[model samples]
Target: MSKTKESIFDYQLFKRLFEYIKPYKGVFMGLIVLVVLLAIFSSATPYITKDAIDDSITNKDTKNFLFYMVLMLGVLVLQTVFQLLFIYYAAWLGQNLVMDVRVKLFDHLLKFKMKYYDNSSVGVLITRAVTDMERIADIFGQGLFMIVRDLLTMAVVFAVMVYINVKLSLIVFAMLPILLYATRVFQKYMKKAFEEVRTEVSNLNSFVQERLTGMKILQLFTRETVEYEKFKTINERHKKGWLKTVWYNSIFFPIADLASSVTIGLVAWYGGLNVVFDGTNVSQGDLVAFIMFVPMLFRPLRQIADKFNTLQMGMVAATRVFKVLDTTSQIDDHGLIEADGFKGEIKFNNVYFNYVEDEDVLKGISFNVNVGETVAIVGATGAGKSTIINLLNRFYEIKGGTISIDGVDIKEVTLASLRTQIAVVLQDVFLFADTIMSNITLNHPEISEEQVYQAAKDIGIHDFIMSLPNGYHYNVKERGAMLSSGQRQLISFLRAYVTNPSILVLDEATSSVDSYSEQLIQNATDKITKGRTSIVIAHRLATVKKADNIIVMDAGEIVEQGTHNELLSKENGYYKNLYEVQFLQEEAV
Candidate 1:
């Protein structure tokens, strides 16, 4: 099923976004003050020019003219200085606000259950974290300042024009309503266009990210051309979306420019007639001042319209970001029991689970693993073996029944405490782009170099690691791409061992390794599982032959269960067939 898209301009979303900036109110208010002062200084400049032209230059008044000119220059310099100060402060506040929101969003995402990630794409989430936050920052930094400054400039210009010549000012101001109405209409259209553009951009980002991350798979399957064609199609759609936004903006600007021109032309014709015929209150200086103020008046209105478009885009991005932040994880740590430690007696009593409603994955599954026991689960893909492990780890909560550890229901235990007691080594091992030493001692942050070496030695990868140029300090590239598959799995094994977990989960941990590395990992597994409850989900039947008990699962039900020899005696049992097939394969090898 597809997820629903949400609107960004929802009032609740804006209210929530506003809350992020609330903490930096002092900086925000100071920026506003600076913007207002800058606008006033900018608007007053034209009057200074008019004064020098009409009174000083025209009338040949040299005494105070120089003083006035110097004063005007100082005001211009002051405005420039304050403008820089405000821009800096606005950028700082905006960046800090983005950081706060991004951190909160990331924290909330981490708390989400595995199901959320299963349903959402990694690319979309990453776009929200990066591109979306940048959009919001742009709005907060420049878009917001533009709005405030423009409005202030417009107001000051209107007030000055009326004070100079009310009759001519009224004629010029007659077009204000028309300009405002046009802006309102354009803003509405631009907002919708921007929202569409943001959505398409998100889709484009997701497509590119997915393709790049899966480039190896695409190349392996010889689907490079096919994927390229698909990417081209998405890119074309993004272009179309951007073009639509540009089309609207293109129309908006021209119409705005025309309106402003008409307003200025009408003001000039009427004011000129009054100066020529009636010799009214309007002066040549007043006319020049009005013309200068005309652009100032329409310039801000035009800017407001343009900035509105940007603000809309930012709102769209914010909506996407807030969607993730607002999501309430179904599995919460609330009302959980806290414990100092855990004893590894696990029970799954009549447990039922489903990733989606009405589609049961695990049907009334029940099992028990005693303390310090090795239990092997053998099954084909999608037979619910991994689902059981996931449920045990509380990655996905069971819809029905109870999973308990040492007589305490896992749901009643704190998630951190419950997870702290368990360590997992999966087939697809993930190593961060860091040194091998860091990967092993991930759970124990303060682990010493000696402990890291001991853990690596236990996993039987110490000699190979030491042979590397930098030994334990050798950089593991993204996803451990620099290392061989077997080597990466060995590091994961060492990591799991270092945790000293009460329960160790090995889900095809050695499946990717070669025979030699598999044997080494298997030997390390023996030491790691000593005195701990262990669950091994192995595809290679030989890997779990030494398990204390083996549970054979088929279609989400345990069909057979016994020791290796006992299961082999049942000729028609699933385990026997699996064991025979693996044995034949090994013999062939």
Candidate 2:
């Protein structure tokens, strides 16, 4: 994923994150109440101790001392209860918020245009959806809630200390400005370090994912050592990124600790002198209570600084997540026309398209296929054959002309209805790491096992499926790695047929299949295209000789269109030349 420099406080991002928490406001409010109660209980403990020491212990009133002791124990128990409630509810709220975020992000990705995925990394997307979400959860579960809790405790402790002995309280707070300055500097450096660390983590994940996905290619080319060296460099950068954060942690916390220690020492020294020498104002119990109050005040201050890191990192992660969620590069689906009863009459009128800016792949192309007609487009690589199929399906919108089905522009129909009516099988078939049956039905409960078997039987690949270790129950293992390319292609054919689409598309679908699988695919193709409009994009001229129309393309323009025999009859036609060249190549092979 790409990133821009971000500020430490992204107010907009934080505001967006809080929207997820809105659904759980009642629980959040409960947490806030618990935090305030916990603070009150905590602050009361030191004062209770002061009273016990000065009024009960020193005076030697046995019954009253015992009474205060039990009262102190009860306060501690209540404090523990509130602490436990805060932890539990804070975690509950965080988990629910992360779940909402992850679901929303995934839903957004599903709607993004093909161009976005073309330019993005799978691993980086995974990091944002999974790992970054976990960090966001930590903000509420461990970071934000705890920071608030500590701050409340400290503030309550401070007010009580001032009430007990205002002069001593002033002396204890004298080191606060220095510690605050150190914390500010620490935050600035740590934010930069953590941002770098996040970037490195995304990079490392992307590198590992790509390398592993292409490990077979790497091994075939004997590039393992080079790849490993590259991984080490990435790993080193990742380590260095984290180390920078650790360095800041090492510097920041100790400075906070030292300031805390100095404050404690000063409070004890001044309060102790007033108790022993001056004896006019401060009591022994007041000095004791202030000493106890010092840690409560300074410890939270130090922890607030620590917890701020969590808050900052979550904010950064949230910003990245929101950037993706806010992306506008999704396929436009403004068409209100429902694609019910589509007749599958596809026509492209002088279409122009480009995958990249100002570089047209298909130029001034015009063609039409009537309902139930089979049209084959044959062209050399990069001659705009596949681009036509892509445009017809509205995978990429054409720049200059209209693509229509049943005389209604495709862009005028709802995408879901349009895409659902069309089925496409490309040269490379992708399968998930799931059981064959699940892959076939896509776990759609409406598609029964019987329907799948019938589709496979009709396609004549049922026996091939049975030959597998567990037939339909067998796991394909990521990207169908466990299956041969031919087997995967057969599966793809079965999948397309099962959808019972109105218009079928085969873009060199049999190119990867073996001769035996090719025969089966040809048979399946015939059965599926029997009464539906189908477009076949093929390189092998022989396979397309039986097509209803053979359209020849050259340099992004349609050069010839006719039945195979008619095209071949033209003495110097491009189709005739292409067919002869392919026929010779086949003979040579």
Candidate 3:
């Protein structure tokens, strides 16, 4: 069955969401008390009418009429007071609850294994943390306590109607079965409609976020018209989902209003005959009060059906939010061992990995790098060169064999311990729209301003950064778009350098830089790689020739391993061919 046809409210999902409320139990329970009080005072107003008509108006007693008027006004004042308190406290609790849930969600996402991110969309995760969070807040803000107040008011109205006159109450209640059936049908199908709405909302978020993030590519390929058409189709489906709810509302509410009107007609017919013709227990006072009570009772019943939709939509949001919270894809940090000051010795023993099952991106690859060694890996595209660096950092778990750091299996060391010692500078560097200093230090208080300036000077970009408007404080804007490709590479190198990692990874991205930046990049590379266990995934002959060792990868396996002259000594070695091709490309540049 489709998600819409599935069980409307997952009670299990609700119970899990409600667990977040326990931290503020005092405030939550206080709101419930306020709702109950609000219902009591509001329900009392109808019964006030009966006593005023019977004891004062019917008897023509002036003193009794005066007292009932005062009493009626007092009930209204109390109802208004309790209602104000109910609205304020419920909203306060709702905002607090969602705040706590959003924080927990972001924290959970931070520790998730890279494998989880590999398969998940950035837009869907954003929708879960943002849009879905607000909807869950509605569960408390406008949904639960309001439903409680309405139902309690209805219950009191029902009891008062019966107490005033049973036969007349029975006459009114005969119309109830029809109204109740309509409400049941409305809740069931409205939930299904909302389910569709929520699904479409997620799809729209994913599509829009992806398109906007890659807007440059979309424009470059001139696919704007084609993408716009696809968006309209998705958006139209979303429109239909919402209009389906509108269609249900147009049908169900009128049925509810008809039911209420029909009950009032029945009460007037039955109670009038008894009072006028029979002159029995149903008095003029009771007849007058029933008219007031009929609307009071039916109003909440209709509202409860409407509020039931609010509850349905909240549960749908909760289900999606909790699905992410329930995911077990977080990187296992069970190891207790901490990485301390040590030599940088790394090994991959018969390592095998794949992004998908049995696809084998790394096929039993084995290699070793000793302390303070500089190794370069060279390969054509899809040769699993980057996969080795990923496994070393434990970003992904290998399917077979063991990866060790300093002779200890990496699985036995804590993730922070293992990761803090390694720094990687990728081809496509990512920076927040912040100052250069903040991007380099990432706002770490331990790495003060002096340390940052020193690192920048060490890497020879201090002068370039000083030339910008605010120097180190200059805003690079989104993804360092304000700077050139070479500048971004230098900032990444400075970022990786300040950490003083035991192992440095330089994914040589010198393929697209001007001559001036190329010389600066080469100088920065020399400084950062100088006394560290460095691994360079080479795309340039300068980096490959300087390496103490070069490992050639081809189609998920290491094809050859040796120094530059040694690999060149082989007549048909993989590294020799790769180096020659890369050299020709640079010569053309």
Candidate 4:
């Protein structure tokens, strides 16, 4: 499905961005004031030099020369102080703004529904959170100050030049149109080039992360050479994108330099002519001062042009970052109802769902599980089994019909309250890089250490955890890479168990564990599901043999459903065929 192309710098988006930095507005304003003061003092130096030349050097007034020189030196010192102050405050504001953005973006991401992750790339999102924020910081810290300081300096210099000689000022100012036109052209192309560079960099980062995470699989499959070649292609694309940016910048800078030089050369020629023709009215001192201010004008002009590049790049990054922030959490809980307790009864009535429009994954499916019933859903890989569970959890909204818990529509209960009542243990377990104890208590952080220990023991991983070098304090690597699959599963089981939820959903939760660990998980599952509605989606037929009800699904519809014996008695159904295949395989073993 095609996504909408939304501009990132819409007024509302920047208003929200400004809100994040509003607390630091004092420092930001201080930086602006410092920049303006520095620009004023810096721009005044040429006038001092002019007075020194006309009154001291040309007319041979030694006292006035030394006095003006001393004053100019003092002005230089003051400018430097203000410059330093601006840098300090600008850096402080930039760092604080970036931190606030990162924290808010991360916090918002955690609340996002699973469907968001399913649609977005991890690399793209990471770039927005990390790299994009840094770009914005650079814009705020250096880019913003440069823009303000240069514009103010340019304005002060132009006014002083016009006062010194309006005729010469108008001659010099004629180049403004040309400079602006060139800048406009450069800005247009540079914006496009920088956008491509940003996209390429995001792609390269994504490639690196994906390959690094799957390094083991790549090596085992002997696809290292193939992957290396793929990476080379990505790297080359990134290089080309960067080269395009360089090409534009290279052309832009030299042209800008030539334009500035021409402006200065024209001012010098015109001002010198006026000095010669106008004689006493325009002295050598005034011409020299005009020459000094000539470079100042073009310097700020050049800087303003350069700042546009930074601004363009920052705008591109901001666009991407704001795109994420702009996406409304479609599954947000709008219900005001808060429940102190939950009954495990769940019913899906005439429910329909689709990841894409006009393509139903679950078609008008209806099922009801009474409180404390252990129901097993069996299906082929894409038979909408997991989709049903996802819908029950409201991971994706249903197009038609209602899902309820104890006769209350799931939408009527706040998401936190609804989810707090359900615990899900999936086949693909993810454990954070923390102590075993922390992983177990992830869902119930207020649970005591004793409660954690009891939950771990109930899941039969407590002894194994204790046998480790650091017991419950042992650190797991990313996604629990430090532990065996069975150990990770055990931790996940404990995590679900400690939640003390009203409903339990296990999706091949024990498929990775050994027989012994499986037995332990099964025992824990029995305890946890004692008075809760439980939905088990199992690949292994043997795992659900004792389910109170077995649902066999095929092609997005339930083909047959009954207890294990009842389904086994039907010899021609999909469930019976699956059962016979497993039964014969076990016999051969």
Off by over 4 Å in 3: 2-8
Q: Summarize candidate 4's per-residue lDDT along 1-589 as a digit string, tens digits.
A: 1122233123554566678788988887787788779778876888998888888998898988999989999999998888888887777787898898788788888888788898888888889999999887877777767888898888889888888878778877887788778777777777777888899989988888888988999999999999999989989989998898788778877877787788778867876776778665567777888778877888787777677678667777877887787787768688888866777888988888888789888778788888889999987788988888788788888889899989999898998888888889888889998888788787455888898888777766678789887998888978898888877877788888887888899886655668887777777677776767899996665557868888888867778888888988986978889777764475364
Q: Evaluate model 4: give its TM-score.
A: 0.91
User: What ranges in model 1 sit over 4 Å off?
Assistant: 1-12, 276-278
TM-score of 1: 0.95
| TM-score per candidate | 0.95, 0.97, 0.97, 0.91
Q: Write the per-residue lDDT of candidate 1 for residues 1-589, one digit (tens) a residue.
A: 1121233245665677779888999998888889889878877888987787778876889976897789889998998899889888888987999999899888888888999999998888988999999999977787778788889989888898888889878887888898888888787777777777787788888888888888889999999999889889888888988898788888878988898888789878987787778755777777778888888899899998888777787777887887787788757676458766677898989989899899898888888899999999987778899998889889997899999999998888888888878999887889998888887786466678888788777667789789876998898888898888878888888888877788899986655568887777767777888788999987665657878888888887788888989998996888889777775586577
**Model 3, residue 255: displacement in angstroms?**
0.5
Q: Residue 448 lDDT in model 1?
A: 83
Ranking by lDDT: 3, 2, 1, 4
Task: Count steric clashes of candidate 1.
Answer: 1
**Which prediction has more favorable lDDT, 1 or 4?**
1
Score each candidate by Cα lDDT: 0.83, 0.86, 0.88, 0.80
